[model samples]
Target chain A: MTGYLVRRTGQMVLTLFLIITFTFFLVQAQPGDYASFYVLNPDLPPEVKDQIRAAFGLDKPAWQQYLIHLKNTFTGNLGVSFGNFPRPVLDVLVERVPRTLVLFLTATAVSFYIGFFLGKAMAWRRGGLFEYATTISGALLFTAFTPAFGLMMIWAFAFKLGWFPVGKFLDPLVWRGADVSANYVFGNMLLSAAAFIAFALLVMLCLKRFGRRVPSVAAFPIVLGGALIIVAAWALSGIGGLALDIVKHMVLPVATLTLISFAGTMLLTRNSMLETIREDYVMAARAKGLPDKLVRDRHAARNAMLPIVTSLVYSLIFAIDGSVIIESVFSWPGTGLTLLQAVRSEDLPLVMGAMLFIGMLSLLAHVIVDVLYVYLDPRIRYQ
Target chain B: MTDRHDPLLKVDGLSLSYQTRLGEVQAVRNVSFELARGSALGLVGESGCGKTSIANCLMRLLPDNARLSAGRVLLDGQDILPLAEEDMRLLRWRRISMVFQAAMNVLDPVYRVGRQIIEAIETHGVESTDTAARERVARLFRMVGLDPQLMERYPHEFSGGMRQRAVIAMALSCDPDLMIADEPITALDVIVQDRILRELKAIQQQLDMSIIYISHDIAVVAEVTDVVGVMYAGRLVEMGDTSDVFRAPAHPYTAALMSSFPSVSGERRPLTGLPGEPPNLSDLPQGCPFHPRCAYATDVCRTQYPPQARYGSHWAVCWHPLDATMAVQS
Candidate 1:
């Protein structure tokens, strides 16, 4: 474990270096000059414009300017925003980071859970009517015109039906008071405590009923009930309303993204599972009088999940990028939307910051997947 | 030992065919055999002689394309051909099991060896507790002469011979009455094969389980089985008590197989190979499937497929039997 952590840490450092260097070069490559905005101001004198340029070290050569920018970045300053915002770029990003995380993480967890189980169901009952319908509908939903599909969903569900509050952040006053910092801290703590209690209760219940012989018919409903209770409790505190609103807003995008992602995951998993069933070990499992479910779960699915795990982890990077379009269509205030706006305005610092964030996320996901691979597949470990 | 009891398995007029793009291929044609309780019967044949197909039919593990054209496989007097999948699964591993040839690759590499075996045990409601299952697994490992500590290791960690033993241990986990070992030792080295065969013989004696041992090697079958059935072109050409058939072989195919292998204790002679390849099942000859390959084929042999003719307890399917005069000419 130490060796693996050391190797991963080394890789992380290398990844950070590469991302920072690339961001530096790419940001400098933008066409518009940083001082051009100040230059456009008629009231500003020539001396003041030159002083402003000299203050940020923009008057130096591009390479020298890049070095100064890197130095300021390492010193916890992301220079200043080009949009005339007084706050440093890093502070502004930090303020928006939590909201972006709330949206992205919710969408990710919800879509993944729904897609994975739905795919499993389709694969299990492969040739049935439900499976055929899911396959066809999933195909059409995720077609090249997914953004258009998102628009149609908004038109039908949000605009015409008015089932959900259309495209805007919720009023903070509904969940918290005027003092944003105190409200944020207090709400986070209460939610965390509630989540902890709920999780503890769940674990205790699962442990208590671990070996009980429950009827199969009652199993799914019981589990679902437990999950609902946990989710309800976790979303009970301040920002919970905001989180709920976010989830409601996320539904169409999540469903749209899941539709696109599910096609490949479903196809790959079904094929792999079918192939695994034909393997000699599956026959051995049967010859040992193992029940079909046990054989499939313990023997077949465990081994077959190796390829899917890799694909799922690798696809996360693509998913992150894909969310850019989804965020734009849904008008969600996420890093994806921020990055898009930054790109349009050619805000180098903001765009580079977003890119750096994405690059790190991709790297982190890859590291996690590599470690999981070793756990899921024994052959790699000893080999 | 000679108590009168009905055979554990009776396969009557079993014929299997596959509907391929070319045509229907009669893989196993009119094969019949009986395996008594606590006895081993060997089905010896060359490659493509329908040996594996017969095994598949017995287990009802045939692919979608293959059809059981005609047959009734009775397991202890119960017809298995028309049994539901669930019922068949209940009988499988608990009453009837099969050990395939490639035993090493048969294990799930992701799980621990003991966990895989425990999964099998628990699936059949053999043991419930982890401790009890571990104990049972340990006993099984000891039975197969493997260390129980190795249970935590994955499949890839073990050697080929050990993996085969592990598979056999898993097969015996349910204590099935009939174990079909389909060329179990064919993929192993000669020394390992000898060890496995001996181990199988000992296990058979201890458990008193009937075994249907399929192989292509005549001498290996002779060493392990009490009754040997020689197959040619999907048909059982000859079958009888091992010594009775070996001492005075009545079938020409059996004579050819015996002559092809170099005997450990026999006079040296020119090695004789079978005349022609086994005929393609889809385009088999009308008169006899083996007539094209048989050296002693006559006009009658070319026109009519011979029926099994009984000589004492032994049976031979031939138009012309090898007499003393005919043996000299051959």
Candidate 2:
């Protein structure tokens, strides 16, 4: 397995290199560079525009410019953003990527758990009314366009009902400066640590109490109890109102992403589970006198989970590409929105920077998935 | 004829049907057999004759669409039909386990072979501690001619025969009272098949448990079974002691089946193939299911279902039962 990981890591590096090479050339292949945007300004003279081009090395041949970009990238110099002149591309990305990551990563995790378990239940009660209802509704959610769905959510929940704010990451009117003081940050960190320790103790308690009675399902309460404790600890801290406001702002966009992806994930899980439930091993498990739940979870769900895991890895890899349309629709200031504006304004530095990060993310995600495969399937020998 | 002293397993008039999109298929019809303790009964038949269905019914392992439409499956003194699904689950594996036909593919590929068996043992609440279960699993592996160390490997890591042995070890883990081996060695090579059969016979003797061995190969069944029943078109056409059934088949279908198999040390008789095919269960012929393929089939055979005819303890479904005196006359 170690050997396999090493080989896969090498392959991932090569893949990322190829992706960077292609993206760099392709973005440059356009008629002009970011300097052309400056040419359109009435106050700028043609000679001044020419100087700006030379200073930025856009006036150099494509090969020379590419080599320069490669050297700068290797030296950790992402260059100044043309869109926001004098600001480094890496600095701009560092500010925006985490927000996008938090939003999409949380949404993906929430939707996966919901969809996967719901799909398993649907398959178990196959041909029943519950199955039909979930299948039909899940299909509708899966097939709906993302932008349209996001808009509908915004219209219904935000605009018409006024249940949520129309849009933006925060309500600036309420908090004035919503960023918390460093003292609060330190306090929250301590609380978070306390919550983590408490959660671990809770799980041990649950295991001691219920593990022997229900050996197959003892871990479930630990996860559930742990989540409750962490959330409770956060809410009980002095900054609960601020956290609540952020969660409130997150509702619409997160819901839209969750609903849309939940359908597809659930459907995929259901179909794969249906196929797995029919395998001869399932029958063997059943014949072993295992209860219905254990048979489904231990024997059937583990096998059905393979395809779902693959899709999950691919989704994570592409997540950095941003949910561009959803971000635009919600007016969420994430990297996806940044990528769109950068491309439209022909900010070559920012575009290349974002693309590089995305390419790296994809390669890293692939390696992580390969590593996880060894744990999920023992038959997968590294050699 | 059931009493307090009835056989360990008595399947009386067992019938099952599957409801598909097309229609209902009567997979097993009025199939009855008794298995005493410490004996093996082989149900021999071609494909689609409901051999596997019967095995499934015994374990209550049928799919959602398939139902045990009629009859009672008596395990010891308890009728399994009326048992709650939850209760039936307890009966399965612990009381009556099954080795599926695709034995090689019947283990979870993601888990170690030993872990899979341990899962069964643990699920059935056989052992309180993991170490005790591990020790039992190792013993089972050795009993089935497998190395205890090989238990750490996944299903895909083992060869076909080894996988079958693992499956057998799993079935025996709980020390079930009845083991239903559904064509356990059909997919294996000749040498592996012989070895597995020998291992199975040894296990049977050592464990002293009844087995319902379902297979298509008469020769394979003869080597392992004390009693044999020949099925045609979902009906048991002939049944008796294995030796009597093989030496003197009362039913023409059984006789034809016995004649088709080549003998290693006997007169070289040209093999006679049974003509035509088994009738479809959804739309069976009006009379005897085997009439079209039976050379001895008469007008009465084609017009109505044959009554049960007896010779000593052996029995067959036939209108014109072969005479015993004719054996000397011939």
Candidate 3:
């Protein structure tokens, strides 16, 4: 295990180095740098243009600048953003990341929960109205154009119904009274959600270790408690208004992402579950005299989860890559949106940072998926 | 003597069919038999000959497409055919459990072997406590010649024979009155098959339980079963005491099947194959389903379905009996 971890860490570092070098050179090779804004200005004199170019490091040779970039990135100095000057690239990315995390991670979690649940239902007692309806609708939704859907969602929910904000991450009006930043609240929400998940897993671990079932009813109180705890913590910290504002702003995009992505997981789960139910073990489980519920959940659905879990982990890692279209459509300030802006304005520092982050996360996701595979599926454990 | 008043199980006129795309596949037709309290019965036939269908029907574990056209499965005089799913669930594993075909795949690979068996035990509420249920599983593992410590291992970790034994241990978890072992050891090697059959025979005697061992191999079943029923193309062609049927072998199909196998202890003889395939259930011949394959098939065999004809204590559904004195009386 130690060897595996060490090997994966080395691979991740190498891959990130390649990503940093590749994106850095690609953005550097663009026709002009960020200082071209000043050079193109008729009002600016040649000497002033040269000063601006030097300040932005565009006056140096491409190879010379590449060396500085490699050293800074390696030393964790992502450098200052030319577009959002005076602020380091790391600070800007850190601010935008939690918002993207809060949005896409929530969507992924919600979609998976719905998908796995409904997919199991569809496969267990197939040919039902519920199964057909969901399958038909899920397939259509899965293939639907995300941009058009996101726009329709904004039009219907925001423009027509006057529900939720039209765009952006937070309402300046609410934040005027509250001193807390929206990013701080989004960060806290992610932490609290993570805590609740850890707690739920701990509860399940205890129950499973004892060979006791985690009764369905028992989950309700724990979930209710987790919600209450999160709410109380946010309210007591006096940033409930700020958190609510961010949530309100997130509604349209999150809803759109969830609905579209829900179909993918649902259909994948349904197909995988269909195959799993036909496995001889499922028949053996039934012959074991397990009631319909236990047989479906324990024997069939759990086995069906292998492929879905793999798909989910890879998708979640790409969530760090962020959705350019989703973020742009909503005008949400996230890594994807910022990456787009940086690329357009030739902000090499910011774009390289985003690419390196995604590359590192992608490798980490592979490691995580492999570890989970060994844990969830014993057949692969030996191999 | 068998208990006429209350046999362990009485499957009366049990017929089952599946509604497939090709129309109704009559998998099992009017198959009836009674199992005594402490004896093992073996149902042997060629593949796709309704042997498995009978096992599934007895456990009430047929697929969604299957229809139990007619039957009364009486366990302790209680007809279980009309029982609701909820009621049948309670009856299953507590009354009639099954170790399915290819016992290697019977265990879910994700769960530990002991947990899967414990699930069977806990489902029936057989044990008072979880620890007791686990202990029962440990005892069962030991009973089936598996180490109790190995119970925590997954199905993939165990060898093919070990998996079969684990499945056997699981079937015995609730100690049902009758255990239907459908091709239980067919997937294992010859050496493991002999060991498992021996263990199974010992377990049946030690627990005083009835078992219906279903197999296509007549030789394997003959060794472990007290009574043997031979089926062909969805019908029970012959049934009698194992020794009686093995020795006399009245039906031509039975005689062919017997000769198909090389007997280990008997005098040396060349093995013979029963030519032609078992007729498709949906598109069977006009008369006796096995007549096309039977060497002694005649005009009477082709014109009418044969009913059960007795020859002393043994009964066979055949137009002609091999024994010279047995007249064709149904």
For all the models shown, what interface RMSD does each have?
A: 1.6, 0.8, 0.9
Kindly report which residue stretches of model 2 are placed more than 4 angstroms away from their true locations once superposed: A1-7, A45-47, A177-238, B1-5, B326-330
A144-241 per-residue lDDT for model 3 (tens digits): 88789889998999999998899998888878866666666788878887898888887667666763745655766877887798789888887777
Q: What DockQ, on C-alphas, does every prediction get?
A: 0.67, 0.81, 0.83
Model 1 per-residue lDDT tens digits across residues B1-330: 334498888999999999999989889988888989999999988898999898878777787789888989988888999999888877777788788977878888887888777776766777777678889888889988899998999999999888888888887877788888988987888899899889999999999989988888888888889998999889999899988887788888888988888887778898898887878888888776778888888898888888767765678888776643333221
RMSD of each: 4.0, 3.6, 2.0
lDDT of each: 0.76, 0.83, 0.86
| Per-model TM-score of chain B | 0.94, 0.95, 0.96
Clashing pairs in 1: A281-B106
lDDT of 2 at A68: 86
Residue B309 lDDT in model 1? 78
The number of the candidate with the highest DockQ is 3
lDDT per residue as tens, model 1, A1-383: 78777877898878877887887777677776566677778999999989867865667887876777677766766766665356567765665555455555555555555555566566555687988887787666556576787788778888999876456444345545533453354346346545655765665567547753343445456656666775676476444555555456556666656656666666666667777777888777766656667667666766667788888766677777766787788776767887788776656677767776788788888878887888788888621
TM-score of each: 0.89, 0.92, 0.97
TM-score of chain A of each: 0.80, 0.87, 0.94
TM-score of model 2 vs. true structure: 0.92
- Best candidate according to lDDT: 3
